[model samples]
Target: MRQTKIVVTSVEDDNFCKCRFCDKKIAEIKNDIMVPSAEECYKNGNVPVPNFGWFCSQACAVNYETKFDINFAKTKEGKIDYYL
Candidate 1:
């Protein structure tokens, strides 16, 4: 199966990126300068959707998914399957 790739880019200034759902500011840096996993990123209150943008929280992600009729399923191997 093909895994989903999420890329996180750093910003020069404080205005990093905005949440796609709530329009909240998401910081590019925190303390350490290491790439975080999707779960880690979501735990920090910012989930990066592949085609879409950043989502503030899981609630927002769910809201967006439901609103757009997008369905996400996790395989037995823990891979996410996205469908309409």
Candidate 2:
């Protein structure tokens, strides 16, 4: 009989020291929340995980969601299109 050894891999840390949304300094790791950039939020059309509070912390994300149409448009051929 042969015995095999297994290795464990660790997840990469973002090390977010500040809250991207509120621009608040994170005193602790638990309190830290980092959001994506304005372009990312706009491209995704939604907020990503770890992004607490508002969207990308930029006015652009807010404007995109607020002023733009959030409705999903579909063509007669069954093609779907999302606008924001």
- lDDT per residue as tens, model 1, 22-78: 767654444533234544555575666556556676677677777889864544654
Q: Candidate 2 on 2-81: residue-level lDDT in tens?
A: 43221212222444433334444332233332234333333543322222322333343344445665422344653222
**Any runs in candidate 2 off by more than 4 Å, and if so which?**
1-16, 28-84
- For lDDT, the strongest prediction is 1
lDDT of 1 at 6: 52
- TM-score per model over all chains: 0.49, 0.17
Query: All candidates: CA RMSD in angstroms?
Result: 6.8, 14.3
Candidate 2's displacement at residue 51, Å, is 9.6
| Top of the candidates by TM-score | 1
How many steric clashes between backbone atoms does each model show? Answer: 0, 0
